[model samples]
Target: MTELQLTLEEKIGQMLICGFDGLTPNDHIQQLIEKHHIGGVIYFSRNYANVKQIADLSYELQQMNAASSQVPLFVSIDQEGGMVARIDNDEVTLVPGNMSIGASRDDELAYEAAVICAKELRQMGINVNFAPSLDINNNPKNPVIGVRSYGENADLVSELGIATIEGYQSSDLAATAKHFPGHGDTAVDSHYGLASVPHNQARLMKLELAPFIRAIQAGVDMIMTAHVMFPAFEPEQIPATLSRRVLHDLLRVQLAYEGIIITDCLEMHAISKEFGVAEGAVKAVEGGADIVLVSHTLQEQVAAIEALIGAVRSGRIQEEQIDVSVKRILALKHKRHVGEYEQLTGSVAEQFGTAERKDLIRQLTEKSITLVKDEQQLPLNLSEPTLVIWPEVRHHTQVDEPIVQAYTLGPALAELGANVKEFRIATHPTEEDIQSAIQLAAQYKQVVVVTYNAVSELHEGQVEIVRQIAARNDVALVVASTRNPYDLNQFSEVKTYLCCYENRPMTMSALAKVLTGQLKAQGKLPVTLSPEYSFGMAAQ
Candidate 1:
C-alpha cells in the first residue's frame, strides 16, 4: 500500500496554521481550507460560546477540510488550565495551573492534571493541546510565565514536564512542549516586544534547556519555538523562531528531536514588529520550523502562504525542505488517527464537568496552598466580623483587555461561618482608594487583604495598599494570590501571609478552608522567596 502524495499547494498549506474571528466557520476561514488548503487552525477564547458550540465548531472545521484536502485538519487549543484555559465556561472543569503542581512536589498530581485535561479536550473534538510549558521560572520579574511554569529548579521541571507528556500521549491526544529552549528567565514579555536571554551555552544547559531535553527523551509530539533572542546561541541577536543555528544545529542536531517543530504566533509583537508577518513565516520555515502559526488576520495568513510559494518557486526555499516538514506533519496526524476525516460520534456531554473530574481539581488546589508566614492571627474567630479587601487585577499576558473585577473571598468566607464585609478596589488603586480601604479596615475586628500579581513593578500600587493597611491595623492578613512568593518581602509588618499561587475558583475555595482550619496547609515553596524563607518552607 502506498500513501497519496500532496501537490505543491497542499504541501505549502500543511506548513501554515491560521486563526479566525468567528465562533463558527466563516467565509474567510472556509476559503483558506477549501482553496488554500491550510494545515490546521488554533482556537482561542473568542471562538468559544460553550462546550457544545466549541465541539460543533471543531467538527465543522474538520468536515470543511475533508471536502477538499487529502488530510484532515489539525484542531488545537491552548488548554493549559488555570488562567491560560481557552475553553473556560460553566460546563468545563478548571484545573490547577503548573506552579500549583510544583508546590505539591508531586509528579503524580501533574500527570493526573494532564490526563484530565486531555480527556476533556478529546471530548470536544480537539486532537492537539499546546501545553505543559517546559519553562523554568527562575526569574521573579518574568511578566508572562509565572504559575504557567512547573517550578524554578531544572530537575523538578524535568520530572514534572515528562510526566505531563506521558499523561497526554497515553490519552490519545498529541501534547506540545512550548517555548523551546525556555522563556522562563526573561524579564520582558514577548507579546509586547522581543525578549533576550544573555546566558551562555553552559548556563543554558544547566538551567533553561534541561527540561526540554527530558521532554525530547520522553517522545513529545511537538516542540514550539520561542520568540526570544539568545545571544549565546546565535551571535547575530536573532530570535530563536528565525535563527537557523538555534533551531537546526542545536535542537535538531544536538538534541536529536525528531518531532515536528512549530513557531509561536508570528503575529506576536516580537516577530511582527521585527520582521513583517510574511517574511517572518518564510524565515521560520528556513530555520527548521515545520509549522508557522499565523494566529490572527486572514490577510496575514494568505500573505504568508503566498510568500512561501514564491520562495519555493525562486529556489530560495528548497522543495525538499518543504517535503520533509509536510511528511512529519502527516506522520503525526496518522499516529493520532486524525489523518482521515470522520464524523465524531459519542455522548461527550457526560464527560464535561463531571463530579469525578471536579474532585481532582479540588484535590490539587488543597494540596498547593502555601502558608509562608503566620503569627497568631490565622483561623480568625468565626463569631467576629472581618473586612475582606479585594483588588481587581488584569492578567499580564492579556494587557489589551479590561481589568478583571475583584474576586471576592467574602462570599466563601461567609459560607465558612464568618461575618464578612467586601471592599473592592481597582487594578491600580488610587490614593483615595487605599485610604478608603484602610478606613474600612479600622472598624472590623480583623481584615484580610488580597493582592494579585503584586510582585511585578506594574502592581506596586497593590503592594503599597498592603503596606498602608498593615501599618494601621494590627490584625491585617495578606493573601498573595500570585505565583511569585516574593511579594511578601515588601510588607514586613504584616503578621500573616498566604500564597494561593493563582486566583482560580478551586484555589480560592481552598484558601477559604485553610483560613478556617478546615484544610491543613501542606504545600511548600517551590522557589526561594528570600534568604530567610527558602525553598520547601511551609507552616506546619
Candidate 2:
C-alpha cells in the first residue's frame, strides 16, 4: 500500500488506533473503521472475556476491515504481564512481572516469558504488544509504573528490555518499548494529571533515558511516547508526547531511531484534561508521532481524526509529513504480515495455557519471590492458628484493572493447609479499620500482614497498621509487600519482610510455598529498599 494511493481521510485513519466498549464488533467500532478508516484497535480488560471470544472478535474485525480498507488493523493490547495485563483468563498463560524477572537476574527467563506472551497474542490475532516497559522505577512514591517497570538500575532494565524486545519480535509480534525518555522518576500518575521529570539532560542520559537508547540500538519496532514532560530538553511545559524536541529531536535525530513512534493513549488526563484529545492528537502527529492512540470515547476518536484532516486541509500539517508516517506504518504492517486475515477454527490451541507454561510461571515466581529479611520468622508454624491481614481487592492505581477475582494471601495460606483466620482491611485502611485489625491480632499466635503499595502516601494507613501490630510483643509479626518492594522502607521495624513484586495468583501461590518452607527465597532485590537494605539484599 503506497501513501500516494490513500485519500486524505484514509491517511488520517491509518494513523489512529481507537478503542470501543464491546466484547464484539459494534456500530461504534465499525464506524471507526468504515467511516474514519482507523489504523488499529486497542484492547482493554473490558473488551476481553475469554480466549475463544476475543479470538473470534479479532478474526471478525480483520474480515470487516478487509472488505472496506486495504490496510489491516493493528490489533494491540497492553499485555505487559503482571499488574498491567489486559488479557487474564483460564485459557491464557500468565508470567511474572518485569520487576520479578529483574529480581531473578535471569535474562533467559525474561526472553522466554515474552516469547510465551507473543505466541499467545499471535494465536488470538494480536499483532502488536505495548510491552517490555523499559521505565526505570527509581521513584517509590510513583502511583503508577512501580512493579510494572524492570527495576531502578539502568543496566538491568536495559538488558532485560532488550531481551524482551528480541523475544517479541522473534515471534513475529511488534514489540513497543514504552514511555519514551522515561516515566520512572515522577510522583504523579499521568493518568490523573501532568507529571514531569525535572532532571537535566546529563542525568536523564545516565538513568532515565538509558533503556530507550539501548532499545533503539537493539532495533525496537515501536517506541511509545510518555505523557510526562521533560523541562531540560523540551522547553514547553507540554508532555513529551506533544514535544518535538523530545520525540523528534531527541529520539529521532540524536538517537538516530527510525521506527514507528506511537503515542500513549491521548485520553489519559495528562493529554485529555490538559489539552483536549482532538488538539492533542493533532499536536502528536505534528510532533513526529506515527500513530495517535485514542483508547476511549467515540466522540474523541472522531474528533481527533477530523482534526487531523482539518489540519492537513488548512496547511497546519503538510500532506508530505503525513506520507512519511503512513509509509512507516504500512512498511511495518507489511513486514509483520499484519494485513493477512485468517479465521480460527472455532477452537483455541491446546498450547494456550498448557502445564508447560504453568510450570514456567511457577518456576519464575519461585525464582522471583524475595525474602527481604527474616530475623527469626523463617517458616510459619502451621500447627497453630495464624492471622492473615490482607488489603481488600481493588485497583491499586488508575493503570491497574479492577480485579474481578483477586488471589489473596488468606486463600494462598489456606491452600498450604495452614490454620488461617483471614481479616480484610480497606486498601487505604482507616483508623477504625486499623484499631479493629490490631485488636483482632491478639487472638492469633502468628500475624502476617500483606500490604499493597503501602510505600505511597495514599496507602500510608497500611504502614500505621503494620507498625501498631509489630509493637505487640505477644504475636510474631511478618510483613510482605504484594505489589511494590519499597514497602519495607516505611516500616523498618518489622524483622520479617518479603517482597512479592505483584499480587498476581502465581506470586501469591509461590509466596505461600515460601512461607510454608516448601520453597526457598533465592530472589534478590531488583530495586534499592533503603540505605541499609540496598539492592540485592535478600535473606535466603
Candidate 3:
C-alpha cells in the first residue's frame, strides 16, 4: 500500500510504536494493531520470557497486523547486548556490548558480534534492532550510557559503530544508531528527568557528532534521537525530541540524513513529565521524527495518535508533513522486506544458543576483561579464604531490569572451587553496612570488592567503603567494576583494579577466570578512567 492510500488516522498511527503489558498479545496491543493501525511494537523485558515464547509472539504479532493493516508490523527490540538487552536467556547467544568490543580494539569483533546478534534476532522475527549506540562516553559521570557506548575516542567509536551497522545490515536486519546529537556527557538519566549537553557546535561536531556522521555516511538504516537538550542547537530548554532546530534543521537538513528518524520513548520523564507524552508525540513528528515511540502506556499511545491527528486537522501540522514521514516508513519497510507477510518455520530456535556460539561469546568476554592495574596481585590463591563484597542487586537506572542484575561475580567464583565467602551490601551502602563490610574484610586473607557504576556523585557510600577497605595493610585487596569502569577514578589509591564492563553471566564467568588465572586479562580501557588512566591503558 502506498502513502496516498493510507488514511490520515492510519498515517498518524504508523508514526507510533507502542508498548503494552503481558508476554502475549493482549487486548490493548490488538486494539493498537487491528483497530488503530499502529506501524510497529517495541519489546521490553516485561514482554519477554524466553527464546521460543518471544519468537512465537513476534510471529503472531506480524501475522495479526498483516490481516488488518496490509503493512506488516516492524517487530523491534533493543537487543544491543550487554547491559541493555531485552531478550536475555540461556537459549540465546549473549553477545558482549559495544564497549567490550571497543576494549578488544578489534572492529572485526564488533562486526562478528553484531552478525551473531542480528542472525539470532532475525530467527525470532525481530526485523528492527535499536543498536550500535554511537554516543561517545567521554564523561565518566554519565549514569546512563556508560558501557552502552563504544568509547571516548571519536575515531574508534566511528570505526566500531560503522562496523556494527554494516554487520546488522548484512544480515538483513534494520539497525538503528541511537541517541543522536549525543547523550553520553550528561550526569542525569533521561528516564528520571531531562539532561542537557552544554557543548558548542564545534565541540559537538568534533566529539559527539563524529560517530553519527560516519554512521550516516555508512548508510545506517535508522537514527534514534536523544532526549538530551543542546543549548548550542536550540535556544529553548526543550530536548532534541521536540526541537525542530535539532532534529529537522540539524539532522535532516544540515546532515542530509534521509533514513528513518525515531524518537527515544516519549513516555520517559524527559518528555512526559515536562511537556506530556501526547503533546510530545505531536511535537516529535513536527520536529522531523518519523516514529514517535511511546514504550509503556496504552492510554498515552492512543492519546498520542489522537493528538497527532488533531494537529493535522487543525493545521498545526500540515497533512503533507505527515505524508512525508509515512512515505519514508513505507519505503524502509519495503526495503528491509519487513512489509512482506512471512512466517519463520522449521525450528529456527535450534540454531540459536549453540555450543559454538557460546564458545565465541565466551571468547569475546574473556578478551574484554581488562586488568587496569595490579600491585603484585596477578592471581589470588584459591586455597586461601577470600571475602567477596558483592552489592545487593538494584536497578542501575530506570532502564535496567532486575533479571539483568541477577548475575554476580561471587557465585561464578564459588563455582570454580574458590574458597569464597560472600557478603552482600546495599547498592548504596549505609554507614552501618560500610562498617560491617570493613570488619568482615578483616577476617579474610584476601578481599575482592565489586562495584556497580559507583560514581562519587551518587554512590559515595560504595566509593568510601571501597576506599577504607583498600587501606587495610594486612589483607590483599583487588577492586573490580562489574558495570562501569569509571569506579576506578573514585578510589585511585587502590593498587589493584579490573573492569568487566557488564554484570552479565558471561562477564562474571570471564572475570572469575581472570581472577583464577585461567585466562589472561587482554582487554584495553575503552574510556579514560581518570587523569592517571588514559584510553587503551591496560596491564597484562
Candidate 4:
C-alpha cells in the first residue's frame, strides 16, 4: 500500500482516467483495467441508454476493475444537468442548468438541483460528477462555456457553485469545479483549438479566478484544469493543463487547493493538436495534474500510460510525484467507499424520473422563464392563424458533429388550439427561405420566429430573417431559445423578445405556458445583455 511497494506501471496507471467506446466494457477497456490499471473511467452520452443500463454499466466497470486493482475506479460523468447532460431519458430527471439556477437567484434551488443530480448519479453507481462549473462567464463571445457557467458576476457564480458543491458532497458524490483558472473570458472553444487568456494575474484574480477561489474555499473535491494559456502566469502559450507555474505554483502554492487536480479531456484539439496525446499526458502530470483524462481512443490511452511509465522510469517525472497522485486518488476512493459497485435498494425504474421529479423540473423551468422585452404582444390570440417560423439550428459540441432536429415548437403551439402554419428552415436560412417566410408571415395575423442560439454571429441568417419579417409584419414576436439574450441587441425595432435561456423540452414547455399566460416570467437576467437592459431585468 506504500509508494515503494507499487510498481512503476501501476503508478503510471493510477495517473490515467480513460474513456471506453461502448455502453458495456469491451475487450479493449477490459485490457485497460486489467493490464493498465487505470484509476478511473469517464462516461459520455454514448455510454448510456437509460437508468438501469447506466447502473448496470457502472457495475460492470467496477467489477472489471475490482478483480484486478486494489483501487476502485472513479466513475465520472459530465452530468451538469441542462445542456451538458450525458444521461437524458425518461428515467433521469434533468434539472435546469447553472445559469438558469443563477437567474432564479435562489441558493436553495441551486442546492436542490445539485442534490437531485447527485442522488441520481449515486444511484447509478457514479461517484464523481464533473460539474458546478465555477467559471465566471465574463465574455459574451465565449462559444463553449456560455450556458455551462452560472453567470457573469463572480459573487453569483461563487454562491451558486458553492451551494452546488455542498449539495453534491452531502449526497456523497464528488463534485469537480472545472476549467480552472478560468475558461470564461476566451472567445475560442478549447475543444476545437487552444484558447488564450491575455489578462494579467491581477485581472484574473479579480474576475476569472474569483469563483474558483471560492470553490476551493468551499472544499470542492476536485478541480479540472482548463486547456487555456494565461500569458501572465506562464507566458509560454502552453495550456494551464500543461503549465507548472499555473498548476503547481498558483493552484497548489498560492490557492492551496488540496483536492485532486484533473485535466480536461486530452483528446480535445486544444491539447492533441498542440502536443500529441502521450506527450500532453506526461506534461500534465509533470505540470502537477493528479489525473490525466484521456476521454477517447484506446490507442491514445495506452500510449499515454506508456509515456507516463517511461517518464517515471527516466526520472523526468519522479516516482514520488506519481505516489502523491495515487495516494490522493486512493484517499478519495476510500473516503467515498468506491469499491465493488452495489445495486441500489429499490427498483431504479421507480426511483428515477418519478412524477415528483418531473414536476420539480417543470417548476424550475417556470421560474427560469425571462421576458426581456414585450410590447403587449404576449398572451397571443390563440383563435387567430399564427405563423410559426422555426429556424432549426443544429446543436454542435466540440467532439460531436452537428446534430440536426426539426423544430417541435410548431406542433407544441398547434396543440394550444391556434391555427398554426409551420415554416421550417435550416439554422442559416437561405435568402429564398427568408423571403418565403416573410411572404408567408403576411398571410397570418401574427408571426412568431423561434431562434436557437441565434445571438451568435454563426446564426446571422436567423437574425436577418427576424429583421425582415419584423419589418413587414406589425405583429412579429421573437422567442430566443438561447443562453445569452444579446440577440435582442440586433432586433431593436422588434416588438417582443422572450429569453427562454435554454432549448430543453421543459424550457420550451415553460415558454409555451408563459406565452399562454399560464406562468408569469419570474426569472431575471443572470448576465447583462446590454446597457439598456441590465442584469436582474425581467417583466414581473
Give me the candidate number with maximum lDDT: 2
Which has the higher lDDT value, candidate number 1 or candidate number 3?
3
Cα-based lDDT at residue 290, candidate 1 = 95
Clashing pairs in 2: none
Give the poorly placed runs of model 1, Cα more than 4 Å off. 1-4, 339-349, 394-408
lDDT of 3 by residue, 137-249 (tens): 98887878989988999999999899899999998899999899999999888988999999999999999999999999999989999999999999998999899999999
Report lDDT (Cα) of residue 539, candidate 3: 87
The parts of candidate 2 lying over 4 Å away from their true place are 346-349, 395-397, 404-406, 430-432
Query: What are the C-alpha RMSDs, in order, of all predicted structures?
Result: 2.0, 1.5, 1.9, 2.0
| lDDT per residue (tens digit) for residues 1-540 in model 2 | 698899999999999999999999999999999888999999988899888788889999999998998889999999998877888776889877899888888888888888998988988889999988999999888778989898999999999999999999998899999899899899988999999999998999999999999999999999999999999999888999999998899999999999999999999999999999999999999999999999989999999999999999999999999999999999999988897656666446475988888888788778998998898886999988999998874544567655645567778889999999888887778888888988898787699999988876778889988998888887789898988898888888898999988887888888999998989988889889888778877875
How many clashes show up per model?
0, 0, 0, 0
Global lDDT of each model?
0.83, 0.89, 0.87, 0.83
For model 1, residues 1-540, the per-residue Cα lDDT tens digits are 112387788899988888898999999899899989998999888898888788888888988887887688888888887767787665877777788888878888778878888877877888888888999998888888888887799998899889888988888789999888899999999988999999999999988999999899999999999999999898986899999998999999999999999999999999999898999999999999999999989999999999999999999999999988888998998898765333445655576788888887788888999998888778878888888888765433552233353344777788889888988886567888777887877787677888877776666777877876777645656455554667887776677888877766677778889898898987888877777777778876
Task: Give the better candidate number (2 or 3) by lDDT.
Answer: 2
